[model samples]
Target: MITDTHTHLYSAEFDEDRAAMIQRAKDAGVSRFFIPAIDSTYTNRMLTLEKENPNDVFLMMGLHPTSVKENYLEELAHVKEWIDKKSFCAIGEIGIDLYWDSTFIKQQQEAFRTQIKWAKEKKIPIVIHCRDAFNEVFEVLESEKENTLRGIFHCFTGTLAQAKQAISYNMKLGIGGVATFKNGKIDKFLNEIDLTHIVLETDAPYLAPKPFRGKRNESAYITNVIDKLVDIYQVSYQEIAAITTQNSKDVFGI
Candidate 1:
């Protein structure tokens, strides 16, 4: 079975046929779905998804970097409340994202660090959402480095050096549909990185693989990504699926 370590399956984009979309993924052998948090706004929807698909959907709670605003502390407080109230698979989809707005970079950093502390305290892994702020994310991770800090770098599109650095900080590289893109450079050197340090994700309803590129993505499309990995790693499809699934379990402790 394949585990989609990161997928916003709760996204409204799939509202038209959410159940059917998820069924397609399961039909394609993509069974496990780890859902990331955007903020308090989507918590109820996330909870409902998990409730409906108790065995298939796992949840993570945190305020996403892009959601960091002047009142970020209040959002963080809500995250803390959720952590205390229920169980979750991880503590994230949280990190730095300067790609959109640099105005709240400082708040993002603070929120990231604060949430990292919560994860460490709760002894749960974190799933990071980094975009155009690798250095900033790395700096915070470096300062908070310890045995307690463990998670996946969601939608990893970084240099070899950055990949190694993230791994050094107890993170697994989350390879997604981007790897199947012709211009996605990670595929060029993915073989150099051990599959053990990697996990598969779709970031679905977002970065769909080639042929489906620029279109709305769904978990069912992860097969395209698996196909690309087969070529990149020169391995059997079953082997790629098994190894990445195991890698996902390793990171999420599932």
Candidate 2:
């Protein structure tokens, strides 16, 4: 079975047919779904999704990098509260995002570092979201490096060297639809990296693969991603599925 290491089934893009979409994913052999938090705003909906499909879905709690703003301290407090109150699969979708606004650059760094330390304290894995700030994100990861600081670099689109660096810190690369895009640089360099360092994802409601590119993405489309990996490794679909599923389990312990 395939495990989509990251997806946003709670996204409004799938509001019309969330149930059908999830059913489609299962039909396509995506047996597990790892959901990342965008902020405290979606916490209730996320919890509801988990309640509906406890065995199929796993939840993570954190303040997304882009979501870090002037009131970041408040957001971090919310994250900490959730962590202390319940069990989450990981501390995630957290990192530096300079892609959108540089205004919150320093604030993002502070938030990212704090969350990384929190993850270590909780003895949980982190699901990172690095965008337009690879070096910045790397810097934080470097400072936090230790046996305890480990997680997945979600939607990884970095160079081979960066990929190596992430792996060196015991982090897995969350490969999604980007690997299937025609001009996607990730696939160009991914062949050089071992599949063991990879985990499958869709980043759903976004980053849909080719033929479905630029359109709304969902967990069911994760098959296209797996298809790309099968071509890259020249392995059977079942092999890719099994390996990635095992990788997901290793990271989330589910």
| Candidate 1 RMSD to the correct structure | 0.7
Clashes of 2: 0
Once superposed on the true structure, which residue ranges of model 1 sit more than 4 Å away at CA? none
Candidate with the greatest lDDT versus the true structure: 1
Please report, in order, the local distance difference test score of every candidate based on alpha carbons.
Answer: 0.93, 0.91
Model 2 earns a TM-score of 0.98
* Worst lDDT 10-window in candidate 2: 142-151
lDDT of 1: 0.93
lDDT of 2 at 246: 88
TM-score per candidate, in order?
Answer: 0.99, 0.98
Show where candidate 2 strays beyond 4 Å. Answer: none
